[model samples]
Target: MLDLWFSEFHAPDAKLSILVKEQLYSEQTPFQKIDFFDSETFGKFFTLDGLIMITEKDEFIYHEMISNVPMAVNPDIKKVLIIGGGDGGTAREVCRFKTVEQVDMVEIDERVVRLCQKYFPQTACALDNDPRINLIFGDGLKFVQDAPEGAYDLILVDSTDPLGPGEGLFTTEFYRNCYRALNDKGILINQHESPYYKEYAYEMRRAHKKLASVFSIATVYQFYMPTYSSGHWLFGFASKGLDPVKDADFKRWSEFGLQNRYYNPGVHLGAFALPNYVQEELQKED
Candidate 1:
C-alpha cells in the first residue's frame, strides 16, 4: 500500500492536505499549473498553481452563493458577465434563471475551462449546451474596460486569489471599469477571499475597500466551504444602489420555484450578517 497526499499551504504555520487515490491529470498552462485528483472524502477536485480551486463535494456552496445572491437581489437580470469562472459553475447557476438572455463568460485560460469540461462535467454542463453562454478567452480587466457602457445587468467575478493573473481583477481601475460596464442598477459579485488566514484576510479587506470606493453599495457575505481555507469563505457584493439584504426580492425570487442544495431565502439574508470580528475587519481602515 502506498500513501499519496496533496497539500495547500494556508500560511507559514498552517496547511490543508488530502489523501489522493490518483492524480488524474497535470498540466502547466500559460497562466498556471492545473491538477486533478481523486480522494475518498472530497470525491474529485482540482487545483491551480497548487492551490485548491474547487472540489466536487463542496463546490455547489460557492457557485450557488455567488450566483444566487445577486439573482435574488435582481431576479430579472437579463444580461450577465462572468470573469474568471472557468469551471462554468457560476454560469450554470446563473443560466438557471430563464430571465438571463446573454451570458458572456471571460476566462483568461481556455485550458482551465477545457479540462474542467473533461473532468468536472457536472459543473461544466452548461458551458457548451447553454445557448446564452458565450465563452471568451481573454483578460477580465480588459474585457470590462472595453465593455459597452451599461452592457450587463450582472457581472460576476469568480476569480482566483489576488495574485498573478487574478491580481489585476482586484485593482481600483478594474472595479471602476466594472461599474462603468454595468447598467444603472447592475450588481457585481466577486470572489472575496477568506477571512480566517492573515494573508487572505488582507485580500478580503483590500478587495472590499476598492469595491467601496467604486460602488454605491459594497458589502461582503459569508458562506462555509470546507475545502477552502478555514471552511469559512466570503463573496463581495457590490452594486450601483442595491443593498443585497434590503433590496433582495425574495418574493420575486420565489416565483422561480427553484430548489437549491445550499442557498435559500433565509440563508440569503443571514449570509449578510457578518460576525463582529469580520465586520470590524471591514471597518478597520475607516
Candidate 2:
C-alpha cells in the first residue's frame, strides 16, 4: 500500500484524537498534550512518540546537530549512512556538508517518509532533489549487517528514543554492526537517552560500555531537546582510531556557507564536553 493512502485517510483527525485524548502510553513520552500543531507550509506538525520534531517549518536544529557534528569532526567524511531518519530531516542536514559525497537513508517506515515528504516539504527538500542521497525503505539493523564492512566514512543513527519500535537500535549487536560498517577511521554518532532521567542515563551507560570495546574512541555528548521531560539529551560517538572528540576538523562554522541557530564551531566543541557525573557513569567499564 502506498503511504499516501494512509496519510490521506488519517489526515488531521488522528492528530485531533491525540490532542483530545492526552493519554500518553508508557512507551511514549509526551512532549506536549497538544504536540501536534498546524503549520502554514506543512499543514500539521505531528510529534511522533514525543521525542522527534516532525514539522515543515523548523526541523533544522535536530538534523543539524546529528549530522553536522560528526561531519565537522571528521572533515574527510565522504560516504555516510543514516539509520531510521524516515522524516528526512537528517538527510537535509547531511547534504549541507560540501565534503560529503554520498548519503544512504535506511528507514523502516515508508508511511512516515511519504507523510513527511507530503507535509514537511522543507525538511524533505534535499531528499527529493539531491543526487547524492539513496533512500532505502527497509530495516536498518539488517541492512547494516548485510552491508560490506568499511563502506561508510560516517554513520549517523537518527532514530527515536529506545521506547518501542526504536529499542533494538540501541543494543550492543546494532553497535557492533555499526562498528563493522565503518571504515578504519569512520565515525558513528547515535542519539543517547537523557541524562537527567536515571534509567536513560543508565541505558546510555550500558550502550557506551558496549561501544567502547569495539571502537578505539567512545564518548557521549549533551544537548538540550526542550520537548523532552529532562530537557537534555546524550549522543554517543565511537570511532575505530579517530578519537571522536579530539579529531574535530572544524575550521569554522561558515565552512558550509549556511545559516544555523544552535551550532557554531564553539557550540560544536562545547556540546561534547560533558559534566562530572555523566562522565563518571557513562565511562564506567562493565
Candidate 3:
C-alpha cells in the first residue's frame, strides 16, 4: 500500500537509495542517532547518524578485510585492541583466531553494542560469548592513551567517518597513542575512508600522512563495501616492524584453515595493490 525508501548521500551531488521493507527500530543514543531497518534487497541493516554502518548482505567483506589481513601478516598476534567497532563484526572476525589471547573492545556508545546484539545477532553474537573479549564503554582515544605501552599486538580502528563521536579517533594524537600502545611487532588497522569522493579522499590522505609519520611501516589496502558511500573503501595497515605485504606469511596463514567469504591468502596480497590514481594521491605533498 505504501512505498518506503532509505537513502544516503555519497556526495552532495550523488545519493544511494534502498527499498525499505520496514523501519525496525530507532533511537538517539548520547553519542549518536541509531536506526535499524529491514530492506528488500540488502535484508537487515543499521545506520548511525543517518550513515549506513552495516547491512546483512555484504558485511563480511568489511569485517574480513579489516581483521584477516593483519592476522595473516602475523599469525602470532596474541593481544588485540579494537577501538569503536560497536557492531561487533570486527570483534567476531578477530576472535575466530585461536592465537589471539585477549581482545579489548572500546566502544564509545554502549547502545550500539546492545542494539546490535538485539537486532543483528549475526554480527554481535561473539560480543559476550567470547571469553577473550573485554567490552569497555568509553572514549576510544582515552582508552589507548591510558593503556600501558606495548599492551596490544594489534589495534583495529573500526571507527565511523571522521565526524561526530568518531572524529577524535582520526586525529594524529590518537594514532600516536596507538603506536605507543602497541608492541614493537604490533600492527594497526584503521577504517581509512573511501578515495572515490573528494570529502572522503581528503580524510583518507590526512589519515595516511599521520599514520606514515607515526609508524615505521604504513600502507593502505582496498575492499568493496556496497552499503558504504561508494562501494570502494580502504583500511590502513600500520606497524612498527611488520610490513603487511613483505612480511605476510601466506603459507602459514593458509595453515590456519580459516574459511572466509572474501579474504584469503591470495586476496591478502592483492588487496594492497592500489590503483595508480590512489597511489599518486597518497604520494602527493600534503
Clashing residue pairs for model 2 = none
Question: By summed lDDT, which 10 consecutive residues of candidate 2 come out lowest?
Answer: 2-11
**Per-candidate RMSD, Å:** 1.0, 7.7, 0.9
lDDT string for model 1 (1-286, tens) is: 4499999998889999999999999999999999999999999999998999999998999998998889999988999999999999999999898888999999999999999999999999999899999999999888899999999999999999988889999999999999999999899999999888888898899999999999999999999888899988999999999889888999999888888999999999989998999988887663
TM-score of model 2 vs. true structure: 0.81
What TM-score would every model get versus the actual structure?
Answer: 0.98, 0.81, 0.98
lDDT agreement with native, every candidate: 0.92, 0.72, 0.92
**Model 3 agreement with the true structure over 1-286: per-residue lDDT tens digits:** 4488888999999999988988999999888999999987888999999999999999999999998998889999999999999999999999999888999999999999999999999999999799999999999999899999999999999999999999998889999999999999999999999889888888899999999999889999998788887888999999998988889998888887888999987788789999999998887765
Per-residue lDDT of candidate 2, residues 41-128 (tens digit) = 4345656644335544445566778877787777788899999887788888888887789999998777667666766677778888
Please give the lDDT score at residue 260 for candidate 3: 91
lDDT of 2: 0.72
Q: Count the backbone clashes (under 3 Å) in each candidate.
A: 0, 0, 0
Candidate 2 regions with alpha-carbon error over 4 angstroms: 1-36, 39-44, 50-52, 55-58, 252-254, 283-286
Report clash pairs, candidate 3. Answer: none
How big is the RMSD of model 1?
A: 1.0
